[model samples]
Target chain A: MLLQINDVNKQYTNNKVTNTVLDHVSVSVKEGEFISILGPSGCGKSTLLSMVAGLVKPTSGTIMLDGQPIQKPGKDRGMVFQQSALFPWLNVEENVMFPFKKEMNKQEALQKAKHYLQMVQLSNYGKHYPHELSGGMQQRVAIARAFTMDPKVLLMDEPFGALDEQTRTRMHGELERIWLDTKKTVLFVTHSISESIKLSERIIVMGTRPGRIIADIPVTLPRPRRFDAPETIQLEKQINHLLKEEIDKVVKEELSYAENR
Target chain B: MQRIGKQLVFFVGLVIAWELIVRAGGWTPDVMPKPTDVWEAMKRGFSDRTLVYDLQASFTRLFIGLVISLALGTALGILLAKSKTADDTLGALILALQSVPSIVWLPLAIMWFGLNEKAVIFIVVLGGTLVMTINMRMGIKNVPPLYIRAAETMGSKGIDQFIRVILPASVPYAVTGMRLAWAFAWRALMAAEILSTGPGLGYTLKYASDFGDMSLVIAVMILIGVIGSIVDLLLFQRVERNVMKRWGLETN
Candidate 1:
């Protein structure tokens, strides 16, 4: 295992009110495996991903990367946020080169930035600022910046959640190509069952109410899974059925609370 | 370009109206000098080196006062932003002091520094530091937490985070603060120069008014306005526009 998250639990406390966000969740990821933690909203899926990134602390258990305990955020794990958190002050090339500060000279960093920007097909936008780019282009610059750091793992939290349907579908293909080329370990979190099925080798289905893993289904089908493929359709339907129950529970809880109020 | 053209037309119209009014009203030079009379006075003062001396003197005091306030106020602002204890104890007191006008500090300034350049500089610094501190606090507070988290994952930590992430993100706010401070310090310098005997535009205005030299007084006032506008256009506004454009803060 390249990364191990064993019996991890997380609780958040505010004003003497304690909420258990995750409960006894355990997961193991291999060096080059692509996994998706698929669930509905409020299932603590994002929280779990944040914990692995070392941005949040788990209440119990441990998360180890490369046999070392994850204590704080480092260059080892890179993250792609849902909203493309590119630094607005830096242009595309400068933003990609930012993490290379003090690690190499300016000329070498520029060269490396050029390489990654080319990888993302954004070499023409080296001098353009973030505001000048479209949403998809900005996200591309963010991906280039993250890959330029050459982290051990890439954690994406619904990286295409904000895009329209057509752009989302196109980005899925682009992301798959990038993953294939890099062959890096990835832990993706998303609410879209079809997206998870198309992208991940294994999908961890989670349930709400003190969130925990309910199923771990493997997609044994070959790469470049087509939307019309029988295996892809079957897995999507199965995961949708598993998740519908959890989503209904949430809806009912909210409805009852609203009625009482 | 359109804005400049309109401004030029309005300015020339105003000057022509002033000249016509002074001539038609039959007002003596002591009451209100004609626009051309004031322009001639300006040329004469510049030739005699009196206007240059006063401008240099006033600008030196303004520059020194600005540097001092910028350093002290920025440090104090960072302290207030970063520390809970300091903000709780001293923040309210600082706000109270700032609420009182900078002119109100004149009596105390005179008592402390006693009718010297120090007195004028002291008041100018007082006028600026409070506004700078307030703006710095707002700037630092407004820096998004997302930027910090992103920088941390890039291997920046502790002081490196503060210097690189926090500081650059707060610059837009700081620039706004500096613009407001410049306006306040300019007014405070004038008030101080008028009260204390000094070789500045304010002092020249006072001396000319006492002698009923209205043309000289009007010329000095116009010079003050011109210099202030030039600094704002060339220095403050240009920097602010560049920063805002780069940061994507500007809308259309």
Candidate 2:
């Protein structure tokens, strides 16, 4: 196993009221496997990804990488956020080269940054600032920046969730192609079941009200699986059925709280 | 060029109006000098090299005061912004001290430094530093939390993160602070120089007024006004606009 998350739990407390954000979340990811954590909002999907990236710590159990426990954020696990989080003051090439500030010489870092930018098909935009790029282009720059770190795993929290439908499709294909090239472990978090099915080798479906994994379904379909394919439709329906109860539970809780008030 | 022409025409009209007022109001040239009289006084002062020395003296004091003020203010601002205890304690104290005018400190400054160059420089530094500290504090406070987190995950920690990410992100606010500090320091320098025995414009203005040389006094006042606006509007404001454009923080 490349990453082992053994029975991790997270709780947040406010006004002496303890809220369980995640409960008994155990997952084991192999090297170079693309895994997606799929769930509704408030299901702590992003929290799980954050813990793996070591941005947040679990209250119990341990998240170990290669048998050693993860404690804090490190260059070995690069993160890409939904906002694209590129430094506005830096140009595209400079932003991508930020991680290698002390690690590599200037010439080598610049060469590495240029290679990744070209891989993401943004070779000509090396001099352009983040504000000059479109939303999809900015996200692509973000992905290239993460890739330039040469991290052991990429933790992406809804990296393409902010893009439009057409842009999202193009990005999904781009991400798949990049994954094929790098073959590094990618632990992606998203609320989209279709995105999970389209990209990951396996999908971990989570449910809310004390977020935990409900099912771990493996995707054995061939590459370039169409949404209209019978297996894809069947898997989507199954996951939708699983999430419908969680959504209904949230709605009922809201309704009861309103009545009590 | 068009803007300059329009302003010049308007100014010439004003000077003509001033000359008409002198003729119509029956005031002596000693009491209210005509535009031509003031112009002649400026030429005499510049040719004699008196006003030029005063200009050099005032600007030298201003430049030194500004360097110390900007460096000290930026350092203190970062300290207060990053430390919770410092922000709660010293931050409030700095804000309270900022409300006290730079002129109000002159009596204490003289008492401490005994009416010398040090006293005047102290006032100028006090004038510039407070506004800079306040603006820089706000700049650091307003940096997006997202940027910090992004840098953290990429192996940037503590001081490295601050220099690489926080400092550059807060640049627009820092530029605004510098512009404000420049204006405040200029005003404070004039106020400080008026009391001190110096060859600065303020000192010469007072000396000319006491000797009943109304022409020299008016000329000195105009020169000060022109220089102040030139530095603030031409230099500082132009740099601010370029920075805003480059950072994509332009409102329009």
Candidate 3:
């Protein structure tokens, strides 16, 4: 296993009231596999991803990366945040070059950054700042930055959640191409039903109340899956049926909570 | 270009109004000198090298005081931002000190350093330090959590994180602090020079007032205003724009 998350539990305590965000969640990721943890908005999918990234420790269980207990954020596990999280001060090339500074000199880092930028088809934006780029372009730069590290595992937390529907579709193609070309182990966290079906080799559907895995479904569809593909549509319907119950429960809870307030 | 032209128009109009008032009132040079009279006095001081000497004296003191304040203020500011103990104790003390006017330290400065250059520099440092330190602390504290998290994942830690992420992100705030510090240091310098027998614009103004040389006094006052505004326009504002542009904080 490239990464192993065993019986992970995360609880937040506020003024003696404990909120269980994750409960007994377990998953194993294989090398060079594209895995998507799909869930509703409050399903603790992101929390699980963060634990694997070593950004937050699980309350009870342990996360192992390449047979070692994951302790803290490391270069071996590259993460792409929803907001792009690009350094505003550095240009496109410099931001990608940042992670490689420890292993190489300035010239080598620049060359490697250029190589990744070419991979993402953002070679012309080397000197442009984050604010100068469009939302999709900024995310592309972020993808380039993460791919530059060539980490053992890539973690994405709804990396395309902020894009419009049109831009999001185009980015799905771009991301799939990069994932195919790199063949790095990827654990993607997202709420979109079609996105999980379109991208992942496997989908782990999670439920909300004391968030835990409810279903682990493997996507055996061939490569280059589209939104309107017959198999993609069938799988989307099946996953939506499983997630609707969890999402409806959350909606009812939120409505009652609002009414009480 | 348009902005500069508008400012020039307002400045010329004000000068014209001053000249009219002085001429209509038939004021004596001792009371209120005409615009031409003041300009003549300014030219005379420049030709005789007295004005240059006064400016050099004031600028040297300001430069020294500002350098020391920058070093001490940034160090203390980092400590205040990074350490909880320093934030709780020394931070409280600095806040209390900031509320007290910089002029309030003049007496103590004189007592500690005597009525000399050291006393003047001490007062300038006191005036500038509080503003710089406050601004620097706010700068560091306000760095976005996203930047820190991103840097951490990129394998940056400890002092490397501070240098690469925290410091660069704080550039705008640091520039703002420097601007405020410059203003404070200038005011403190004038007050200190007035008290001490320093060879600067403030001292010249005081000496001229004693002799009722209103033309020379007004000339020095105009020179002080011109120099201060020039430094603000040329140095502080330019650096601020560049930093904002590099950080992509500016739209254009």
What digit string (tens of lDDT, one per residue) describes model 1 on residues B1-252?
Answer: 999999999999999999999899999999989999999999998999998999999999999999998887898889889988888877787899888888788888889988889989999999899899988988988898888878887888889889878888999989988988898899889888887776999999999889999999999999989888888889999999988987878989
lDDT of 2 by residue, B99-182 (tens): 888988999999999988889999999999988998898899999998988998999988899899999989999999999999
Candidate models: Cα lDDT each: 0.90, 0.92, 0.89
User: Relative to the unseen true structure, what is the C-alpha lDDT of residue A166 in candidate 1, on a scale of 0 to 100?
Assistant: 88
Preferred candidate (lDDT higher): 2 or 3: 2
The top-ranked prediction according to DockQ is 2
TM-score of candidate 3 chain B vs. the reference: 0.96
TM-score of each: 0.94, 0.93, 0.96
Off by over 4 Å in 2: B1-23
Predicted model with the maximum TM-score: 3
**What is the descending DockQ order?**
2, 3, 1
Q: DockQ of each candidate's interface versus the true one?
A: 0.62, 0.65, 0.64
- Which model scores highest in lDDT? 2
Q: If the candidates were sorted by their lDDT against the true structure, best first, what order would they fall in?
A: 2, 1, 3
Clashes by residue pair, model 2:
none
Residue ranges of candidate 1 with Cα displaced over 4 Å = none
TM-score of chain B of 1: 0.96
